[model samples]
Target: MPKRIMEGKVVSNACDKTVTVLVERRVTDPLYKKVVRRSAKYAAHDPQNICQLGDQVEIQECPRVSKRKSWVVISGGTGKPSEKRIRAGQDAAVEAVDTGKIQPKKAKKADEETVAEKTDDKK
Candidate 1:
């Protein structure tokens, strides 16, 4: 029998040598007869750790490598975000900070000052 192969997007790569791929498929609802999207996450073995988040990868069924990982990454890098796109996102975030559109966390010194004021008020 032929092994099952699937294509999905890598949603997480936090585990060492493992990636979580999210596979989405459209199925027709029996009662409503409308098409609906269904998705499932599969833990795939990534020996090389080449797969990155948001990358489109092909996974193939294989003997279990771990408790939850039964699939292995066969191919990837087709849909990985480009360096320019990532840099653009970082630039946008910096611009937001510079323009005061996004407020960053307060410094520890400010927290200390607030704590001192509270103590003085109590006294």
Candidate 2:
């Protein structure tokens, strides 16, 4: 059988070589077909001790590292920057910055319009 890999943010890094990763799974009720989000926290082994709380890490199945740990951290476990994970983060930042089509930054203020300056200089 192949090992399973998961990517999520580290919610806890209080223990040595260990971190709690919160993995979210989406499921739908068979009867109602209602979409639901299921989340689980797994204790993963991070041997390098680089992961910090809130950091994003990729973990893979491995020989049991502890009573509760069934996975180990993978190298290049992308730290602070979650390159593409969407979770009330940078993507939201991009959206926050996008005020639809942007009004020119130098657009004259409403009270600053000048009629003589309105004619195109290029014309």
Candidate 3:
């Protein structure tokens, strides 16, 4: 049988040689027909300890590493920027918004403007 592989983001690397990966999947509700996102965290073995928090990684099923760990990290993932830098940028944006230093872009009311133009043409 083929082993399962999953792509997820590293949520924690606090444990030595082990990192927690968060895998998210979108599922549609049968009754409401709405899509909802659900996530699961799995502890994966990181031999080189290369994965950092928020870094996207690919994990594959492997022999059990410990009581709750049965996955191993695969190298050459998405290679996104470091999580710390990403969070710093995000925090700065949030701070700017909170301090009123910047304004969020408002969505354009294009449909409303088009209707108003049509009304003017008819009148």
Superior candidate under TM-score, 2 versus 3 = 2
List ranges where model 2 is wrong by over 4 Å. 75-79, 86-123
Instruction: Write model 2 residue lDDT over 1-123, tens digit each, in one string.
Output: 999998777888899888898988899999999999899999999888888778877889999877999999884344564656655676676676796643446755653555445655545
Indicate which candidate wins on lDDT.
Answer: 1
Q: What does candidate 3 score on TM?
A: 0.63
lDDT, candidate 3, residue 5?
95
Of the two candidates 1 and 2, the one with more favorable lDDT, higher being better, is 1
lDDT of each: 0.89, 0.79, 0.87
Per-residue lDDT over 1-123 for candidate 3, one digit per residue giving the tens place of the 0 to 100 score: 999998888989899989999999999999999999999999999998888777888899999989999999985333475466679999999999999999877867997899899999999
Query: Candidate 2: global Cα-lDDT?
Result: 0.79
For each of the candidates, give the backbone clash count: 0, 0, 0
- Pairs that collide in candidate 1 are none
**What is the per-residue lDDT of model 1 for residues 1-123, given as tens digits with 9 covering 90 to 100?**
899999888999999999999999999999999999999999999998888889878899999999999999998754565455568999999999999999867669888999999999999
